[model samples]
Target: MSLDRRLATPALTTLLVVLIGLVTGCARIPTDGAVRDGTTELEQASEIGFIPAGPTPGASPDAIVQGFLTNAQAGPTSAASFAAAQEYLTPAAWRAWDRYVRVLVLDGDPQLVPEDLEEGATSTTVTGSAVVVATVDERGVYTEETDPSTVPVTFALTKRADGEWRISQLENGLMITTGFFSQAFHLTRLYFPTPDLAWWVPDVRWFPRQTWRTDATSEILAGPPEWLADSTTTVIPEGTSLAIDAVTVTDDGTIDVSLTSTITQATADQRALAVAQLEATLVEGEGRDVELSDGTSPLPVPDNAVISTPQTRGDALAVSDGALYRVVGQSLVDLEDAPSLDGLDPTALATGPGDRPIVVRDGSDRILRLSGTGVPDVVMTGRDLVPPSVDRFESVWSARGNTLLVGLASGGVQTLDVDWLDTRTVRSVRVSPEGARVAIVSSGPSGRLVHVAGIQRDADSVPTGLSTPVQVGASVDQVDVAVWQEDTVLALIGAEQDGDRAVFVAGVGGQAGTGGLARVLTGVTEPTWVTASVGSGAMLVLDGDDTLHARQTSSLWPPVAEGVDLVAYPG
Candidate 1:
């Protein structure tokens, strides 16, 4: 939960530090070793998936990665040797490895040199294991090769599994630009299980130009054309690693990613970068790719945007053409004519009048009565009905005919009896398109307040349902009522607690729709609220500055509507 909050909000860059100094400890590859091509050997081993010896037999995976790194630096340049080393890569990790190796070693410019490499470093404590650190000598290459300089490099590595060791991080020691160069190392983390590859002295530092050739089966190793292994998924729990099959940005603002990689914590973190980078790009319009780190794109998002509630069938009838109607259904069978408050604000919608009286609440915390005669009479208006403790009207919805429920930011429910225009304190209330029901969110003194569909027979009696409060994502902190598809009740949940906000949709059915929470969209800045239009697949999210921001549910890309003024509904 805490981690989700950190990721959702604006935060510092994630750093990697292990691979930085991995080679420093054992600087030289074994002197007498032959550069045997282990390519065929690794390919054969990878055919059925790299299965190392079971529990009591082989060395741990980390030890294996270390062995490979040491061997690579020794003298072997065989494709087969590198293939043996490829066992530690994830699908995505492999791409990062391939990119790095091609750029820094095989096709390197040849002017860069390491000044030093650090070993025996410690990082954050992991689950039962500790994170380790390392450092490497950094080199700077002039474009024209006239002058070159050496820079210090540092890295952070996490010690995972008893046998599974991974080059969990990499970074520059200096913090002048991004302040923490660790993010650079995370690039290959999504692909490589261990950071082990030979270093080539480059004359100048420039982007590597080797292109990877991948099919459903064949994969590239440290550089392009170096076929490493063939597999659809790389499982690294034991001897396996993650691998990336393909990554491309479509013309329609969609990022299509194909993964043949392992699914592990390391892989997840690595994939998060790719996903974040893509999502950030969508959030940022044309010409601006989100580049968070030197290696990853930092996505720029506005501080906030307004979130919208879904428009439902019952609500749809009332909101079609911005006109109003009275809807009643045993199961959406009957809807009748209702009086329209043509000049009211969009927020003033709760219910309208027909043969059955409609209960309505407004921004003023007052319960107004709407009748078939097109007259809106005040039923209970003022502090007497709203109570002095209530702050502001966050939302208002109909529980049933002539019964209205009002939600306040101060955390209290107000039930208004429209027949006599009286008020009462209700434990809980849920307003569904079918009817209104009272519900209990939690049994103990502390829990999320739940509202469910129910009924009211008499002014003093209320019948509740079995439904519970909708369960939201772990990090969700707030929600607004939304009606979508007529039957589904949705609540737009704010997933950030630290002023960083993204919106999610939760069905307001039984148990608060625990099974129906969907991650509709993310990467919005200061998203105070959200609402969705069912017909157009569009959504409106409010920013912290009280602006109505609109976007489509299908694309969720940027060029979204910003700062829409909220005003009275025009007649």
Candidate 2:
């Protein structure tokens, strides 16, 4: 079955079951169920349903507050669920509540502590507290709180005319447990186009299982996020909206998108780009297509229009003993027709589009471009320069301290302005595969920081500057290296709380705890260098002993090559 059908029927029913359990005052909701061993399916196939219950009469202030908190879990997804929860609150309090403001995901069940009430007092306050693991903004953007902290939740209740306790005052947003969050919300990717329209970049968003399609389509029309606004462009015309306010799938497996009259003003090229963006964002697996219409008339997309998918080169590049080689199986083979590095003492290497190699010389403070058969050309020279990275546009990117320098394809190098990295030393800089975003590792008063920012380019696709950066992997400390594992994910070498250095995976936008910020490998001794293949998620690391290791299916990092110094994949 298609993913949309699976989610629309089974997964959505599972969410409703969990929400109904919360409203019915179930003591514990089972997040996981037993599955048969050797099952090939990714998720279990089970359908469970329940009827949500409202508040019980004569309940105490503590029960009312607890019930209110539990029922609020459904507020972000279902209106009926929120209305059922409102029975525990007074009319004024319910009217004042705004569930769309934000959502706080707790580490576990919240603790309700009732304040000491005076004799015959008509009102009492119950204080709720829990360790927040993550938060969802009004835009449905999920930010994992790496440094989990305890936050206070307040609820004030009073006796109504029927002598039943009803909440009179409370915070605005919904508070849900992490278990509930995992079951109810899904991580979705919304695709945007690069300035040149050659590749698509993914923007991560979290939506409830029942409303993901509508939410994703609306967010696409609204444009990219704040930090990514300047780097990416959308062909969807301004002021365009969904005429029906919902995206529906037909029995023929086609996604029907009806737009407002504003889309009618867009040119044919604009419509084509819009269709490509929609297909990339909405179509998941094979055998699915997007059908667009401006309510009445069909908006056709050209059949021959193509937008290439971003991918790295097939083989990884490595430098050993002043020679460049390609990693093949368990051995390193000499690169064919490669430029000689007899006395240059190359230490780091990166390949750009068309297998163009750029190397950094040890102790020379210079980056050189190596052709098939010629002398190496000096591309960039600076003090304390990190390894150089070449983007798809063939522009070499390197950083000296806090300064960001880019070597243009036409000629001289340009110093791009990065106002956010003030006074901090840049450790590493890497451009995304599509050349739409750049990942930077830097250090300041708050230890090491990993940031991914959008790269702004002019009309001619020349490097201009960077947009505001969004920090990722905030929990990891003392980061030494950060590389792009995939379009929206990063591989980081950092430690947590002075622990041993380990390999961690973090999403581009602060998705730390929820299947992000995961520690993949540990027990490596004083690792110095790390690299990942963008085409395949393969990773390699160089330890202090000059031993090169590759990650296996398990946590083991077995030695792949001995006496290897540096390794990297094409950017």
Candidate 3:
């Protein structure tokens, strides 16, 4: 989602009044001075101007703890708010605290219980508890907790020499309410190029809205995250850094990025690729351009420099009654000039690179590749193979039992060894359109697990293995299928608890509620298969009754075609 900085009118007005009061209280009036007239100036206030209140003099222990928690919510976005929050803590405590360690998102306000101490006591402890819904690490990666539970928030307050109660000890990180987090931070994606530079892969991150542009650019230069490092590559030269501390946006929406002289060592192609990556990461609205410099000379971008966004063909592919057809405008038309599946008894189908159809035979469990000469060849065989997923590299992915196999278009098959998939039965496997990542659904002792990981490949872009998997949709207990709706969104066919099978939208980097398993379609009668087109944002699902349903804007899934066995978009 994009940045949402809107605040309620009434709330904004109230905050303005509070700020005015604070400013007036700190100003000193000169009553004896003569009235002198000068030019009057008024500056407009920023829409996001809201300074959190500082600690009150002689406040109680619980009051100080509560105030600290409230003010810390704005610490990530505003330096004034962070300074105000430090007022509630002792000198030693402020030094000991590390605000970037972790961010605990709470369901609501925490419960603070202060200890009853004698009137002369100098120190006391306050116990706090809140139900944590999610957590963000120092790198701003958000992970939704599978189960929400009450977590302790303890604080130790001591009376100082000035007869004021200040927090002396607390946790290293800050605790914030979900409402505050939603307003202060935004979920953004950093783009990186694949090994071959054919497509852009997204790496999700959370950043404070006030400094998102600078943060995003710095992260792009720092390289992709560990989980995605092997699959993606960067063109920026090593040791390249921002010449200045911040990235500046001009009045006309042009982004000016000045880099260190290390960028001078890059080749022309490398410089063009670097510019493409910066533009993709920082350009948000129309008419915005990213200009680069080395603090002296301007770096020119190539005229044909282009970074590819993952997109699929407009029409979808489906198999019905042992025949392959192209879905066009609610009608199934025979695929012309393509190999006929007349006698193959195809049950499932997928389109590889260049619209080549890969079919899975009904009873033989063999994957067949249809040639241009109307001949079908068995590429791989298994006891019970899932549907095939083709990547941009012309490699096909499918799983059987706990083993993941890739059928190379150049030659034989190779079995991948995924350490994290130990003993888990592979239910479904789908390669992303960018060919840099793969999504897998499996079942193990912990029930259904949906994971997305970067695809590791060799210098020739051949499948080698997968990076460490990151679990997605942790709350989904019965997931049967998972498809990529976009680079960072997944369409999952699963149910929570004992609910019926339906369509859920899951964000790759964790969403707001229920561990990213937000139900998009309810009352879907046993959705067995699903596919989505990234270009059109259209989704199709195959129900148990052999009816193909398409998603509409009104959240309704109307049947598009009947007696459909499988559906898929070009991968």
- Looking at candidate 3, the ten consecutive residues that score lowest on lDDT are 1-10
Q: Write the per-residue lDDT of candidate 3 for residues 287-403, one digit (tens) a residue.
A: 988888998578877755677887775468788876777887667898776577676767667776557555454454788877778777777998888878887767778888889
Ranking by TM-score: 2, 3, 1
Model 2 ranges off by over 4 Å = 1-51, 74-80, 117-121, 512-525
Pairs with steric clashes in candidate 3 = none
What are the RMSD figures for all models against the true structure? 22.8, 5.9, 10.0
**Alpha carbon deviation, residue 201, candidate 2 (Å):** 1.7
- The TM-score between candidate 3 and the true structure equals 0.86
Which order, best to worst by lDDT?
A: 3, 2, 1
lDDT string, candidate 2, 1-571, tens digits = 1122222322133233532212222232223321001112234333223344567788878888776765667554555667778898999999999875787876556778898878777899999687786787777787767577899888899988788889999888877765456445556778888777788888887776567788889999999998889888888889999999789888988999999999988888888888878888787788888888989577877754477666676577777877778887667898888778776767667778657655555454888888666677788887778888888888888888899988877868989868999968899999988898899999887778988899988887888889898887776678888888876778888765547666777776544233232344554566788877775767788888888888754356778788887788777
Query: TM-scores of the models, in the given order?
Result: 0.31, 0.87, 0.86
lDDT string for model 1 (1-571, tens) is 0111112211111111122111112222221211111111111111011112211224443343333343222112223334544444333444454223211111111122222323543222111111111111231110111112333333223334443444344321211111111112111111211111111100111111111112111221221111112101122223212234443344664443333322233343444433342332223346433222212332233332221221223221233334444222211122356566565433343331112234444445465545567667554554323211110122233333224544332334556453321232222233332222222221122323223322332232232212222232222333333333222334343434354455555433211111112334554566654444333344455566654444533324343323332211100
Between the candidate structures 1 and 2, which one is better when assessed by lDDT? 2
TM-score: which is higher, 1 or 3? Answer: 3
